[model samples]
Target: MSAPTHTTTSEPFDFARAASLLTDAAARAGAAIMAHYTGGTEIEIKADSSPITNADRDSQAIILEALKVLAPEIPVVSEELASDLTASLGPRFFLIDPLDGTKEFIKKRTDFTINIALVEHGRPCFGLVYAPARSLLALTVADGEAVEATLPPDEAGADLSKLAQTRLRARVADPDGLTAVVSLSHFDPETEAFLSKLNIAERSSAGSAVKFLELARGRADVYPRFGPTMEWDTAAGHAVLEAAGGFAVAADGTKLRYGKTEAGLRNPGFVAWGRKAGASHH
Candidate 1:
């Protein structure tokens, strides 16, 4: 496949501008989520059996509006609005999981996140993952450079005033004693078998895209997923992982690509790692 084309105008993408937009969108989404959260709204099950709440709708609306103003020409495929235009998407688009870990959100676990990615030619070129409850935001571009910011502790939501930024890079561990990050919500037999095949030294469980953020921050070495996921579920996290000197690939030894088919946007099993040998082992 050809490399994905970025959405650039006469000038190159302004990273600062993009980050600013993302931060603002995240803050607005966070506020919307908090309102629903405090109201104790009842949750409904979607057609796929996934839980949805007012938080999901309000957050998605905020994000969609912000992105339209920031990059109006770019098309977006958000989880909340995917069904409306799944069949009409072109080659390049934005894949968004406006509120990931809805289950966690409904349970008030504070592990949910707002995810967005700029996908071109079926690959993510820029990504943003924000955990508003924790005031953590991760952003990355295509060239393996990522940064994280922690917002200040404020009752208001995603306080921009408390932006403490830091560059992120993966830690190189001993190839023999690698660690793996697994999701606390979805663990299947296939993932267990895959883990048994490796000489894993430790295992950690996290919620939503935070697992990927752990790997990107060098706190974890590998993350393997054998169960079903959607393109929006992993696109932003995948871009952040790739930009932090890591890659998420199919268990069959291929780079994980997006925009599979009209039947659905489900993603196959994949592994994410910081080292090439990790991919080989999987």
Candidate 2:
């Protein structure tokens, strides 16, 4: 099935169809990652000191090839291949992180995910996050519509239509207190200070796009990060959150935008809130 090219036509892109197609692609990538997860795989450190394994490359190959058949006209900006990338594509393109949370994966944790997102006009319109280790899949099928499902843990190639999916909606924030999802590996003082200002009743620690999944599922209230992050790292999760009636913004509270060519595709610090913006948001 071919996808409608947003760059060449006036027709509205078929987000639901695209989400289904990409979820399969993400699932295939997940299987490849799981193959490596079970064994002792050699790791190589990137120039930025981030780790990469053969699993990452294998997953990238699978997703990139799948994107070609699914949406040939749309260019993809993927994490494993964008080390020296300094420019954006046209108004529409794909952002892929074949394997997010490498640290968690390396530590034999279950928080890693495969992230895929479509960015149009500087905002993510469609997104998919598949945590293969946990058999959890989350995605945006349309504006204000996101869904989560549990895939068969051992069958990454399982039929998606057979899975039971639950619609996701961010819960309204409680005025008295809130539940915050914090990064398990990258916690810092700035995040601590930010959470201190809010009436936080509890804090849940997680890695990768799982934090966004938590908020999108109404399991958490807010997620904030002051540390550096790349666009591919957050776009898919941001899209899922937005589709579930949530929002993510830069440090100044403006909506987070993609395609940062001048910034080398790096993202500024951002805050994500479920349902509504925080009254005390800066």
Candidate 3:
């Protein structure tokens, strides 16, 4: 089914309820990931030689099943299941990256995560990223409310009310004193050249969508990703940052758009930054 392209402020889309359901869904996926994390799952080679495991497959299965029940009308585009699925997608769709950091997950690092996003008219309308190994969960519906909470031991039965919620806010970047975040797995010279243009105070590298988390939480000021990326890789993070009053813009200073049919689902260079970054840093 086609998704709604726009909603008025009074629209009946309940973000809290969506966040609740996504929390449970992500927690389930995370559980599936952790099960194989310590249990030693076999890895297979994808066409690109990237690592794939039962954890990735099983986690996507759980998330796709959950999303089907949550929003039956919306289509789903998942990384692991893409091979068997068709390429055509609706204006609105659910995107999933059951295991975002395969290398990190394989090495038992805590940088891995599970990502889910709802795209409407080429923009992220809802997003959730759960770092199961790190016990951190982020949720946003692009309704001007974004939050990050700790996943309780019983994530499946987490008390949505009792969860300590921190409303995400993007802090202003002192351009000359900014803490820049970069990719840990795929650092390239292009990114360095981009950073040199900025007056940065420190540089940090991380894996998966955690870079978005840093910006949303007001811990970091900017994340300039110049290397290759897919639509799924940035959609969830983009939604979360937007909800937190931040932005993900292209090289030409335009907001990032999704659902690229011509580019084969790949993304161009984009900079993820806080709300005050553009006004103050530029």
Could you tell me every candidate's TM-score relative to the true structure? 0.89, 0.93, 0.93
Ranking of models by lDDT: 2, 3, 1
- The collision pairs in model 3 are none
lDDT, candidate 1, 170-251, per-residue tens: 7765668878899889988988998888788999887899888988888888899988888999999988888887888888
lDDT of 1 at 274: 69
For each of the candidates, the C-alpha root-mean-square deviation to the true structure, in angstroms, is 3.2, 3.0, 2.0
Clash-forming residue pairs, model 2: none
Off by over 4 Å in 3: 10-13, 84-86, 153-157, 277-282
Candidate 3 residue-wise lDDT, 143-251, digit = tens: 8678999994243636556778889998888756889999999999988998888888998998999899999999898998888888888888888988898888886
Alpha carbon lDDT at 201, candidate 1: 94
Q: What's the CA error at residue 207 for candidate 3, in Å?
A: 0.4
Candidate 3 TM-score over all chains jointly: 0.93
Ranking by TM-score: 3, 2, 1
lDDT of 2 by residue, 31-105 (tens): 888989997678999988999999899889988987888788888999999966686477888999989999999
